[model samples]
Target: MARTVVPYSSLVANGSLAQPAGTTIDQSNGMYIAAARPELTILRVANTNGTDRVVTIKAGDNPPALAGGQGDLAVTVAATSGVQFIGPFESGRFIQADGTIEIDFAASFAGTITAFRVPRGT
Candidate 1:
């Protein structure tokens, strides 16, 4: 059986600004939830440091679940670089009770992560 999802305000928006002495996006083991039951439209992780950065993003709030031979799901960004994952919002892809998104990175590097999502169900 398929569950029906309620429609929310498509104009709802949320994000965070991480900067030097701003928001430490390092080994603090931080987690951010965009919205409750969100349909993600855009997700971005930007490296604003002067060196390479190792960033890890996990779906949901669990530690990690690797299906393939691939090791820790991570991305390496060069100095002063960024990466964005953008596409049409899907119900199952970004849906979470609070749209939980986890991000971890090396201590030496600095960066900012943000996501744009619309929570399903009013």
Candidate 2:
């Protein structure tokens, strides 16, 4: 199955940022984002379930075959309206060969997920 692509909401400097109605998490196929400038990308995960859920940012396979490889980052979002902001990913460690970052969910998740890209300055 194809992964869900999360569109990025660009942030403006010295301006008001609109709140987004994020996309629903694709627990089955997972998700991905075009990470051209990974260092400026951020992910927002909101959990609306009664139980805590784990969100995993799968590590990239770029520059493979090293002594010690990077592992996936797993973050726990607290239950009931809990929100977690993750990233500003390192390109070499999180950007895939196809120029995107992959995300996975430990289990069925409730709520929405949003991606944000910060401007170069501020």
Candidate 3:
């Protein structure tokens, strides 16, 4: 039997989730998955500076599918604001795999995120 492990990761940004330098997903950063299960994982985030930060997770192509048509996983943080719980969204609702997923703050305060997991009976 073949086994698969979800590509667990997280990102934190100052001022905005979108940035010129953007963010990176790795151990050197302050984000990491401390606990994980077949269906869920706990992410730990520590605010380094006073500036409100936005953290996000982006699944490449072939993300886990949601059980229902709950929609793609997307996170939205208001301007100059931060969010704690971002998802449980469907992976298919965001975009096609032809290009990178983008979250434009100039267009809206809402951000795009990956669905945390699919519902049962998908």
Give the number of colliding residue pairs in candidate 3: 14
Task: Using TM-score, give the best candidate's number.
Answer: 2
Tens-place lDDT per residue, model 1, 46-116, is 67888787765544422222222232346687778665443333334333334544455677766665554
Q: Give me the runs in candidate 2 sitting further than 4 Å from their true place.
A: 64-68
Clashing pairs in 2: none
Models 1 onward score TM values of 0.49, 0.91, 0.28
RMSD of each: 9.6, 2.1, 12.8
State the TM-score for model 2.
Answer: 0.91
In angstroms, how far off is 57's CA in candidate 3? Answer: 1.1
Q: Rate the local accuracy (lDDT) of all candidates.
A: 0.47, 0.84, 0.31
* lDDT for predicted candidate 2 compared with the true structure: 0.84
Better of 1 and 2 by TM-score: 2
How far residue 11's Cα lies from its native spot in candidate 1, in Å, is 7.1
* Residues 32-109, model 3: lDDT tens digits: 221222243322222233354454444424443233244333333434334344433233433224423322222222
TM match of model 1 to true structure: 0.49
